[model samples]
Target: MNIITLYHGSGGKGTHELIDNIFYKYFYNKILDQQGDSSIINNINGRIAITTDSYVIEPIFFPGGDIGKLSVCGTVNDLAVVGAIPLYLTAGFIIEEGFDVNDLEKIAISMANAAKKAGVKIIAGDTKVVEKGKGDKIYINTAGIGSLRNDVNLGIANIEVGDKIIVSGTLGDHGTAILCKRQDLNFETEIESDCNALNGLIEEILNSKLKIRFMRDITRGGLATVLNEITNHREQGILLDQNCIPVREEVSGVCEILGVDPLYIANEGRVLVVVASEHSEKVLDIIRNNPLGKEAAVIGEVVKDKYGRVLLQTNIRGTRILDMAEAEIIPRIC
Candidate 1:
């Protein structure tokens, strides 16, 4: 009974006990305590944004966070970047038979703590068990809902020539950390995943009255991919200064050894902010004031071009077209 078994997912006494002792123990709230099939959310009286994501990270536990924290943060960030104030979340778990109960509890605790920090509620969740060898230790899926701020207008359509592009923080930390853990690559400096909830930082920026054009959390496709995506089919291209983009030395070293570019690596907590040049400096100051955005920098800007493209100004005074990643750089990197 110390480990998860098929009976624990059978929706019987065992399943009820699991919910009472684990999920409810930490996530208990007036709304979720109702234990209904669908939790009712009352008094949400504005535009709402919703987003869903699944986490199947190779190592359930990483240096700075685990899959549980990643799941909540990822979903919350998705909603926040869309000019929303994250409010509620729903989680689903697929746990394999023979998984350690202690590990499961730890993950649940992580999720609960992350939810509390993000100031959101876990309104509902589901659990399922898979055959021992049929699944990984665990996989988590989360959906987030947030009330949209009426004052904010964010989209690619609002992007224009002379707009400034800002990145919240260092890139490739999450991807490099996962890669090191998976590949067992040892180095003098340890890389930790920058997995964190960005709702607070994002909300502050949105409330600053800046002309924020667009925002996106840098995830699977990395900064280059996001830039390429935003510039697609636009009249203006994006030009980036190579030196301004923040990349930890250790991360850069690992990318160099692996023959990869950090720009194409994934990040969990990082975001791309596109704002008009007039308000870019104020926006940067606001971002830097937050703990999650201490390393924020204005790395690029929109420029005139017939063909929308993302161009990087190399340190060697050469420019190159930065394209979307053709293939997955690292798989299962949340």
Candidate 2:
């Protein structure tokens, strides 16, 4: 039996067998697998936004979303965060041979729905099949390209000390949902995945009367990690009121029981926006009215700080530091 015993990476017969049997079979797409030293790609007009990601989410199916939707939404968000309007995407899949085709089709449909919502096209894709027990039921790798428009320059450097931080909804739902699915943990209220495309939010910001300095979707490392990354570009500190932060009761309860900080949890549908202090209210208002951002709120503000740290303004009216974790608080949940 050609059971992969984790030596697939070894340069031996088993590795070759796995590669030849699985990868080459399903991943047969045009303009790929060529032995050329470099690929000849046609050129277009403006700068291209490129982002790649691999999905290995445990359980594959969860409360609010599955790996398929996450794969698409995650790619679209990556492009949107950089001020690029996503245009095209490519999906590459590695599937276990005995995996259920009906489940795979459901995933594909969910992915298609997500792409439609984001207004991007899956122009090209490849698929491969592996022997059972060799690979997980499925893993998806996505590469996307988008065109960055003129007059839309946004990045961490654009973030100023006085900028306001806006969150597009509640946090910790996605993480808690996956955790519940993983351990069969039950709760009074089911935690749903926040996996959704932020394209509409970005579109509204671009087309509407609001101005944004910078934006990031709170994902893997969560809101605190994202803000910390921005602080690296400038000497900015973030101050947030613990009570002002919008979190669902169920999510908070799960976090409390699990001893996990909700701020460190992942969110797929939510986004963090840094708006210029002058236009903070308008931006927040626009976000709050949008379909994807109805629960939005101004969570914090950038500050001038020697510490260049993130502080939590506790309900007791005291300040405490929030530091990034060296190891992941939750693993394989995204």
Best by TM-score: 1
Each model's number of backbone clashes?
0, 1
C-alpha lDDT of candidate 2 relative to the true structure: 0.79
* Candidate 1 local lDDT, 1-334, one digit each (tens): 6999999999999899999999999889988999998898898878889889999998999899999999999999999999999999999999999999999999999999999999999999999999999889999999999999889889999998999999999999999999999989999988999999999999899889889999999999799899888888877899999999999999999999988888998899999999999999999999999999999999999999879989999999999999999865777887
Q: Spell out the clash pairs found in candidate 1.
A: none
* Residue range with the least summed lDDT across 10 consecutive positions in model 2: 23-32
For candidate 2, write residues 136-164 as lDDT tens digits: 88899988888886668787777878888
Q: Number of clashes in model 2?
A: 1
Q: List lDDT for all candidates, in order.
A: 0.93, 0.79
C-alpha RMSD for every candidate: 1.0, 4.9
